[model samples]
Target: MRLRNKPWAKEEMSKYPHIVIPNPKECKGNWNKVFGNNQPIYVEVGTGKGQFLSGMGKLYPNINFIGIEKYDSVLVTALERIKETKQENVKFLNEDVENLLEFFADNEIERLFINFTDPWPKKRHEKRRLTSEGFLRLYEQVLKPGGDIHFKTDNQGLFEYSLHSFSKYGMILNNVSLDLHQSDIEGNVMTEYEEKFSKKNMRIYRCEAVYRD
Candidate 1:
């Protein structure tokens, strides 16, 4: 996916310090203070346009939703969406996935969502995939025991690789769906990419991988 340069993105993002967290790393273990409540926090990596997080926040008002996106251009759009929704429980971090641990401490996050992430398909780029072992280890450190990662993608090879990766890491998989839209799963929030892919009749793969103690 090509990202068009939005020269005003950075300047626009600064306007909403409440929605776009300026210093996420400083909040680390004190995310409850940031949200001013003890509600469980759910994070979405590579949150493009903030559609999923916004929708989830509306459905689950008791849960705090944080979105992490590296690109200022992409993240600005998500920030705008959250502002329009006026969702107090929804926030964003304009940060990289590699620095995930820096923003949250052990057992801080309750759940994670990885939806339609870039499928770095080259064998050489396997480590860059969000479902790769390195990322799984990072997730394990931050999420509470029994926390689950909900993942969805339209890429078949990446889906297969992720299933194998999850099993290799000893994570228990559940609710695996090769065609999510056709499945019986309820309350599934659609991301911008998921909606576009569904319109094209593409199969959406989804699964939940739980972390064990």
Candidate 2:
């Protein structure tokens, strides 16, 4: 989906410095200070529209939720949603996922979420996949030992590829589901994309993969 540019997005984001962290890199390793607590941080890599992040924050009040999105226009909507939810534990970073390490210290994050991310289906672009070996290495570097990656996607190809990628990286896979909505899993938080896909009766694949200690 082509993102429509919101002319007011930048100004709107600036007004919410506490929620839309302007200088995320400066908070590196001191994220707990940013949230004013030492709660474990759970990061969502492509936190589009903030639905999942805000929802997760509402459910897990003791955990800090940070969403990373590169586009300001897209992130502004998420910021609004978080504000409406009145969730103080959730925050947004208008930054790219590639710079994850720059804003986080080793073992800073307790878990990671990759919800309905771009499939990058072309075989040549496999490296760009969030679950690809290269990205997994980045996740490993910043994640605490035993930190797990929770992934969900509607694309079967990406799901299959991710399973193989995680296996190849020697990560342990658990709670793998070919059809998430149809599964018995409880407490599922839906993203904007996930809700749309599920309404269309599309199968949603989900899994949790953890790095070995």
Best by lDDT: 1
Residue by residue across 1-213, what tens digits does model 2's lDDT show? 699999899899999999999999999999999999999999999899998998899899999999999988999999999888889999999999999999999999999999998999888988888889999999999999999999999999999999999999999999999999999999999999999998999999999999999
lDDT of 1 at 195: 96
The digit string of per-residue lDDT tens for model 1 on 47-130 reads: 999999999999999999999999999999998888788999999999999999999999999999999998998899999999
lDDT of 2 at 4: 99
Q: Which residue pairs show backbone clashes in model 1?
A: none
Q: What's the lDDT for residue 36 in model 1?
A: 97
TM-score of every model versus the real structure: 0.99, 0.98
The ten-residue window of minimal lDDT in model 1 covers 76-85
TM-score of 2: 0.98
